[model samples]
Target chain A: MKSLFFRTISVTFFLASFSGAALVDDHIHGGDSHLPRPVVVEYSDVESLASGNDDVRLWCESWRFAGEANNLGPWTTVPVECVSYVKTYMTGKRYAFDLEMVSREASRFARSIQMRTDGMDAWVFDIDETLLSNLPYYAEHKYGLEIFNHGLFDKWVEKAVAPPIESSLKLYEEILGYGFKVFLLTGRSEAHRSITVDNLNRAGFRDWERLILRSLDDRKKSATIYKSEKRDELVGEGYRLHGNSGDQWSDLVGSSTSNRSFKLPNSMYYIP
Target chain B: MKSLFFRTISVTFFLASFSGAALVDDHIHGGDSHLPRPVVVEYSDVESLASGNDDVRLWCESWRFAGEANNLGPWTTVPVECVSYVKTYMTGKRYAFDLEMVSREASRFARSIQMRTDGMDAWVFDIDETLLSNLPYYAEHKYGLEIFNHGLFDKWVEKAVAPPIESSLKLYEEILGYGFKVFLLTGRSEAHRSITVDNLNRAGFRDWERLILRSLDDRKKSATIYKSEKRDELVGEGYRLHGNSGDQWSDLVGSSTSNRSFKLPNSMYYIP
Candidate 1:
């Protein structure tokens, strides 16, 4: 029984090490190594192990996996690239470990906004990645390939097929319940208003009083300018903005006043 | 039937004559009549007449008599005092009507802001009667009171029990859908943020991104100066305000660069 257990542990370690190294190579070199790779483990497996008492299994199920017992000594530490590769791989899974962590962080951030009561009682949310998910379409069309095909992009938006992020939708509804009027400020062109409204309704987002979109005619100014201007306009009307939430750093930056910001994870992609 | 119609027409004409005479009397006396009489016909009855074609029935209804055709001729045109009394009676109802109309107008104004593509898009909306329905509560708790009881009003707001005018809620939602970030500027003290947010939430308003209340810490300034300072703050942030909506002329007047103003009906009821 002891021999069999050793053999099983050795085999698991070998497979984990080989798979980790292969993932690292795939990311760094953009080529698949012809090594027999283990099936990607679900995040749930790590969660279950988190409550268990098996040190070897725990390390194996972690974002990094040490080598076999013979090679697990101090001198045989795992490569940083392999650990990063595993983390990236885990984050890519639909039930990703990093997503859970990020989601918890997001919840904490949202609660903090709710608890504020210093005369500022408003929240600004960016539309695209912050509330709605447009990454799939962007990826399918390869929008980042040097030249942006706005006509095609507009056509995609007209379809209004983007889905809302569950966590964001919940936060939005909660904020509304809190009497913080939610303003949806999007970098999307004004031409997309009809489709945006339809999509929001379809996605079950509560109706809002203002949906500030990018101007179709003057494409000269940056989105930052447009958003900042919109923020000022709100201040002019007497709203004390307390917080802002967005996937992009640019979306949270205000022009007139300093606002509390909560960043959503979006390291997988970026939009101009 | 013909006689009845003739009698109805005669009564209307007589009422018109009496009303004309009363106007002249009012002008002559500068509205200081020794005899305390009701002003105009009850607006509710007038509304009923407008809704239906029963002129004779309306006249009869107002006078609370039937088939007294002889009594109808010189219809003392319900005194202007009667009209004033009826208006006072309908103050609550009229205010509601005014709120609905103003809300719709405000929505149209907000749309105009969204339509502008040449400059930085922004809109200003008045707080108090503009965004909230505080009149009923105020009148109910402190009838004809000149000074606002901040503590009591704050308690009312914290309860968040006010029903928002349907039209305003619709317009607020529409504006947010249009992507215009909303600012809820108010003359209320900054300490009112909690209650204000609670009220807005209770009222189902959306997209309220900024709540600019009067700072209690700062030395009191003229209403115009305070408003202008807010406007400058918005301008400094690069927002070219496209429109403004407010119950008071001062709220609209202070935002000088606003392209247009949607004046809320307040000829009969002015706050302060």
Candidate 2:
């Protein structure tokens, strides 16, 4: 039985190695913390054994890539094997760089648009992970290994300590300066209105225009449909969604999508 | 001046290194070929010089990742700096593995669906890079660095020698075995109808219910608009789009999206 298991692992290693997926690592779990910190595995050391986190990390990166591509639909949580990889990514500089790259591109696109003089020109930004950082909350939780619990999450949101995703804040500021009205759209319930408002303000997000959240009736609908309907209402009110930014595809897809859409990186959780 | 140039490269290296984006390599380029072959870089060798293809390769990987995520909008060709990386990716096991991972997940989804006895249940697949590969043609071209020339490309397609994407072929076979009516919906012009049919058959694809291509009237429309119209027509005809697979987001997005959508990796070019 042990030999059979070893052989299976060996086969997996051989297959993944050719794809530049092998790794050498010191298994350094975070000290005095329940969640593991970002672990660095040396990709050049292909001769290293593949029995540990190396193989898991390779597959996790691929999984994360799939997630960001919107190719993996309706996932509930990060794969168990990928929890550490996700933690590493969310905590590491790569996550910040990925966000900055997207924001930079979005900023470039916003600059190119010839905005009309009317106040109707608008840009849409999704709240969580778009404008605010939930890394502190996710780090304390399972880094998306545990199933999402709104009850637990709401408590965190009520604390209103989520920091600004620095890059996205810059994007918001730039778009606002471009004479486009900024509309903050979120899937958060209307019940968290005061806290969400406080959270946005305290996190250095101050703006004109409106903050739209889900009402009691909107709770039962899918994120795509509810958000699409909200966008439809915005268009009905003469708002032109010139630009839309979100961490989830659900926030950017569906009817009345913007002229241009920017998808930020988020592998921790998915909203369908 | 040279020192300043070196300093800028050093700064770029430092920023990218912390993100685990560094490499060492033997600088192997393909022999006597117009398109350079894939170059292998050692990520563990961070202290190595950042002047050559190492820095380019790292950034190229990020660009390709961004492309797959649909964050890079409406690019006509691969970035000039990323031409070699794109060539390597298309020729390497990584691209194949990426395709296999997507197809594997797609197959899993296809198995989970409870198909109806009616012939109206269908799966939509885009031809290029999803059902068939233009890799040989791309390899001989500039690996998507040069501007796309439809005149040159159409001549290549006329030969009808494009091979099947082996993984997607397996997926096609698996879903077909499950009694799902297959639809080959492509952005290819209607002019290539007979050649495409022959090529598909030669490449082991058979018994598809419909091969829908762009007519003269549809040629001027953007791929997103063209595909959405076709999907709407399919839906209007009582066919339920259970699964849709394509190399481009335009093939999967817009109105009448499927119950599930799988995006295959294609960094070579973007149609719209």
Candidate 3:
């Protein structure tokens, strides 16, 4: 039954791909003449957005003059925000933007890890958008304003209607089947524990020896800071993090064990 | 200038805490007459919700009867979905409702590691809510529907409004300053590279030698099956995962090298 279900979902996914391609083509070629086309924001426009914030303005200027011969100051001021904007704006069209270089660099790092691995391995994953697709819920609801809406978000999670990224999900399960312990770390507040677990189970993610979430009453750290601290605690406990996965870079930072990172693509108009 | 800005932000942050606490009390707990009261869901209601799903029902039944004299017919007939639902729900609440026990277990685990450490040191972290405050964004945007609006999300990230858990962030920096390489692992999709980096930078998280995210293009395996792949990858890469922290059991499941696993408090919610 499981095989059959996977097969069914796979087939539907493939079929959907064709339709998706057609839609992309139609839109790219201006098929929807009545709809207002997305305007690409220029460098100038970005600078304008950063006008009030000197830090941002300096960052933008640094980016604009990056690698220029006559530039006086060092490009030490990493305009992380500008990179973010560029990446977000060029989501699906990654190949066409400079941001692809960043991805390529990151991918190269991932590939280096792949080239170096030997023996029984393990990787930790953050739930939400990492292994499963919470974007649909996020898209339908927005960030998570609807999450605190009583049991509404819980219902959505229980339904497990959010679709899976077949390629990624398959990869995750494959890694798990290879005698690796798959750890899931999430910041899905302590308030939605049941629903979060239900969502993962319904989604068919298995063999998770541990599922970690934020505590409701523990008032010690912010989610991101807690994650780093957690890594320290993990090391103190004796677990070797082979590689880490997440939608955010913070997940990959603050650990002495993990050396490689694998990033996925999620530039579909939302920042998180 | 950047140094000055950091100093200012830090000072402001410390001063803001007093005012912030007052504000939180005034706003979050305020609202006696005019504001609509926030609805609180009880544990029983959550159980009822879980019961709606067959998979969750059977899993819960098995869990409830784990050590009972009467065996429940092997409980194998329960659908995988139910098992998963129950698992996620149960584990999600285990920490909050059972923090004392969990902490005791964790401390025991920590003591064991303290004895096991043979002079090597490392750290592992789970991303998502661990290192980043995605909840506010998730809550404010209602799980990513319209509020995940690309532009708006970008603005929020640029601001990096998600406050750091000062104690935790300081601890992480201290670790890094102490010569730790700092590794982070998460289940967030690899698709969130740019914004994740941006968010981290905005939050003042810096100096990690490596950042890892889940690979969207890698067709290695399923997340359920490849539990310890990342840790193995880390070991293969020559980094020892000394301590680990996460809100999920899965994050620490296969980490044999980890000297300690600090399970953060995550009972209110669980994300698959």
Candidate 4:
């Protein structure tokens, strides 16, 4: 069973690599580079930014690796030295490539399982940065170096214009096609529920079993606790929780995590 | 308090980077390159390896990022296409640089805490690929292209000459200096305790609060269950388990996880 699963991924890897090459080439040389405020900033020379020393680049890469691996727990902000590095990564091809890898792995896992007729098997997804991209907002916020202003971020959220993370939307579609129920669980306050739904619908997330947001009482709790409790409630309702995807470790850690959890790369900000 | 911690890490990062540059230079240009079987193989041009396409490189790197983040689970071997990439990573500067980043962050966290007078504050570390590296053995094995052979691996372990992962050795020393009790919790069988101790001592891991190993009864258990049960025992003994570090997620996951867990980069193989 495992060998067959691996063989399928390897074959898929070849196909993805070819498609990914074209996608990357288009982004690198496309007309979007001419825009004053490009949605995805394409850097002709990534190292042109100051502090372009090899050591600094390696240090910043290592810092991101640690952050993704959850080694550096609960960091408040990107390191002052890593600001430009984060910007280049977030606004460049690497971030998209990373997401492609994660979502591919996730969809592969979801396909490997046998779906029950009862339809209890479910995949959980976090909303912001998992399904939606706040890259445009963070782009103006110095890629999260401005110390995360809630009022400013909430105003951006109220616009209901965040784009879908393309790879995640693909994963969402694949999971739905595989007959797994999709659940959108997020740390966003319930006050923004209407806008969140609008954003989700506009960004192509039209169907889900539920869109869970933190209530006033739940807002006071840490993300780990609130998300865990929400997952616990889903489990209590007899959902299998086969797969969970999130940009934050807090979304996957704590009690009642899924059979498999996929973490999307996020370097801008850390939420405990 | 957090800013002070970040400041200390930033200072340490500069110091470590300078020292790391020298270390990397020595490995790249030194006598090891001339050995019949170099201990740490250095590549003049990493792209010299076959299948060095840009897309394939990005794909392999994404695979690694997923593995390190625990998004990829329980695979027996590295992807066949990723063999060269994994080899380059394990024997190259990037792996060491990643380790430096993790250890530095871990030590920073350790330093930020006010150590209690009670000697109950403990740090847990895994043995193989965490404290002691088996790279020399894996280097001979096509960097894990060959599936794991227990007989051959046990023979290598019996030789009692595995080298210390230098960065982790430094972390062990720093944690000891900070008044934290060091506990070596490994998945190695208890039958190899003597050689394990001899190997550890030879590699400069001279002291620890305890060296916990798997007994006969533990052979049937998965690493996650075995390590978690052992950690539960430590917790039962009134130890705080303040920090944990390991190469495999199985060593860091499960019950009694530390306040902070450091994951070292290991793309060669996955252990469940």
Each candidate structure's TM-score, on Cα atoms with residue i matched to residue i, is 0.33, 0.79, 0.31, 0.80
What global local distance difference test value does model 4 have? 0.72
Among incorrect, acceptable, medium and high, the docking class of model 4 is incorrect
lDDT of each: 0.47, 0.71, 0.40, 0.72
lDDT digits (tens) for residues B1-272 of candidate 4: 11111110000000010101111112011111111211221212222222336656666787789889988744555556678889888776567668766876687688877888889999999988888888988888988666566667888999999888877888899899999999998878878899999999998897798999878777656678888999999999999988999998888989999988999988876666
TM-score of chain A of 1: 0.58
- Which scores higher on TM-score, 1 or 4? 4
Worst 10 residues of 3 chain A by lDDT: A8-17
User: Which lDDT tens digits does candidate 1 get at residues A39-129?
Assistant: 3323231112223234332333321211100011111122222333333332343212222223333343445554455434667888876
The digit string of per-residue lDDT tens for model 3 on A1-272 reads 11110110000000010101111111011111122222221223111223344434333322322111111111111123444443332222221112222222233233334422443345677665556665555445433222123245456666755554433465566566554566777756566667677777776777776777666432234334656666666656666666666644345545443644544433221111
RMSD of each: 27.7, 11.2, 28.5, 14.9
Better of 3 and 4 by lDDT: 4
- Give one digit per residue, the lDDT tens place, for model 2 in B1-272: 11111111111321111111012110011011122232222233223323566655655666677778777655545666677788877776457557766776688678878889987889999999898888888888888776555567788898998888877888899989999999998878778899999999998999899999888777666678888999999999999999999998888888899988999988887655
Given candidate 4, what's the lDDT at residue B76? Answer: 50
* Residue B123 CA displacement from its true place in model 3, Å: 28
The whole-model C-alpha lDDT of candidate 3 against the native structure comes to: 0.40
Q: Chain A TM-scores, all candidates?
A: 0.58, 0.81, 0.52, 0.81
Better of 2 and 4 by DockQ: 4
lDDT for residue A82 in candidate 1, whole number 0-100: 35
